[model samples]
Target: MEGKKKIVIGLLGESGSGKDTVAEYLREKHGAKLMRFADPLKEILHIFFDKISREDQQWLALQLRERFGRDIFPKALKRRIENESGIIVVNGIRFWEDYDFIEGFDPGYVIYVTADQKVRWERSSKRGEKSDDGADFKRFQELEQSETEVHIPEIGEKAGFIIRNEKDLNFLLEETDRIMNEIANK
Candidate 1:
């Protein structure tokens, strides 16, 4: 296990499926390093704008992918992780291309988190992310139809582990702990 990559967990989920919570749990409890496939895009966009919205990010991703290919962000993140070690949680694996690329890592795995739509909307409204504030349920539903979110369910089917995040934070942490144990013991 030492010779191989420690643990590379690709997380896929919709807007409020607790992917961030799971990633944070891994980092806090298991000493995992957290990553997101969109880090490069976020960094670039951040330089130009004080805060980037999800719609803006989706647009940027679409524009870049059209020019550099769909696998561009995943490839960039892979380079970032190349020399790092320890449990690395790559959040935001919404596309099959992201899953395919990350899972190629020697110790890669994916976990998909899901939650009730209404519950997700409620949580998302208050999460206070730059893009999600002022979002109504109607807007949340609309975002689901966007190209960036369309592949989440399909890509989630490919996850090595799938967990539901309901209304309880304790339940989420426990499930995350169990999943991490199972992954590490592999």
Candidate 2:
């Protein structure tokens, strides 16, 4: 689990594209190591805030970025993964700069998970319980625009694997499994 060839995977997609679900599945099936970039904010939250809300976490994350700049997470992650090998799945890679940073570590694969706009919006509404108030499609679009640019089409085109998640979960899982097996053999 620790001292195996480090295969870094980047999951890129817009909100509600089931990135987390796919990442979890890959990790469980392949025994891949996992890292979430936003976790540094959560790690030290108790030192700064009494009750760490998501907004608070986001604010602290912004603060860290302000202090450390765009490469903070990736640089930190590089060190954490220095002695680690095998499949290392990076969850929540937000920026293009972050992508380049991870790419510097090794030749890795990017997987873009996608779904139809309606399905994606519905999933976002259901999953964004702490953040969004059930809103119109235009409003949801604007909100997502305010967040990270998903670069969905570009990322998808560049991805080694593309999983269309608008179908049933079982189908998605099967497609994901096939991709994992292929990547593992590589």
Candidate 3:
């Protein structure tokens, strides 16, 4: 019998959609490696800036995409993990270009996690990340609009599986486990 092939799972979602939670679950339960396309930008910010604000990170990410191309970060990540073995859970896939680029690689699955806006807003507020610290409902909407400019909704549509993360942690974990099993069996 042939051995199970390595798989790459690309996570797509808006802010507070539980992509990180899913990735962490995959890592802890299934021994998958967690990687994010934002790592490069974060590394650059760490080197040059004393204190990198959320706006700075967003600006740098956008500038990098605009200057280098929409697929720049995804391509870099692909190259970085090319020789790896086993499951790789990639978080923070926002654009169709990112989807297409990663999909071109072998044995990849794109999973879109979705939650209602009100639920997401509450979660984001409770998390209180520096970027989301002072965002009111109007500000949240504005930020979400800017985020949508990257074509996240279209990317979500392109996903192989859409996981609605509206319920509790147990439900999310069960759903993630089911998806992982399906991917492994494919």
Candidate 4:
């Protein structure tokens, strides 16, 4: 641990699982460093492929992985976080590739947040992301399930802690704080 920079907390969960909110809370409350997988993809797509549709952006993401292999983004993000200190939260982790890539660094903790399906849809609808297009339930489910082809449990089982994000924000925050303390004490 002499050469290790700081503790990293990787949060993996399904869409609308409030991962972003939890990450923000951690940054605000714990003064943790943060990196999100979507930021790089969004920046690259906007700069190089202007006027691309959301669907096309998604397709391009898949193509980028196919071309560079899945770990490119995760490795790049990890490099960006290497100099940081204190707790760091990695958001937007998707595939098992992403998980395994981060696991290589041996993060101090991995937390998987989950919510009820109906709550997830409602939250996603209001989250202001592409998934929040106010579409029908079936359409939304198809779109969401397609984006998250793998099951959350597959990743959650790998997490050191799990938080259900259905209650009030303060309640969720309290639970997150408790879990953070629990992990830090280990």
Task: Give TM-scores for every candidate, taking all chains together and pairing residue i with residue i.
Answer: 0.94, 0.80, 0.90, 0.86
User: How many pairs of residues collide in model 3?
Assistant: 0
Best by lDDT: 1
Candidate 3 CA-lDDT value: 0.80
**Candidate 3 residue spans exceeding 4 A from truth:** 1-4, 48-53, 147-150
Output the number of the TM-score-best candidate.
1
Ranking by TM-score: 1, 3, 4, 2
What local distance difference test score does each model get? 0.84, 0.73, 0.80, 0.74
Writing each residue's lDDT as its tens digit, candidate 1 over 103-168 gives 898878999999988888888888778665559999889988888889999888878999989859
lDDT: the better of candidates 2 and 3: 3
Clashing pairs in 1: none
In candidate 2, the residue pairs with backbone N, CA or C atoms under 3 Å apart (3 or more residues apart, or in different chains) clash, namely 4-86, 5-86, 6-86
- Minimum summed lDDT over a 10-residue window in model 4 is located at 49-58
Candidate 4 lDDT, 151-173, residue by residue in tens: 56678888778998999888889
* True lDDT of residue 173, candidate 1: 91
Q: 39-70 in candidate 3: lDDT tens per residue? A: 88889988987656556667788888889987
Report each candidate's C-alpha RMSD, comma-separated, in the order given: 1.7, 3.2, 2.3, 3.1
TM-score of 1: 0.94
TM-score of 3: 0.90
Task: Give stretches of model 2 more than 4 Å off.
Answer: 1-3, 44-63, 133-136, 150-153
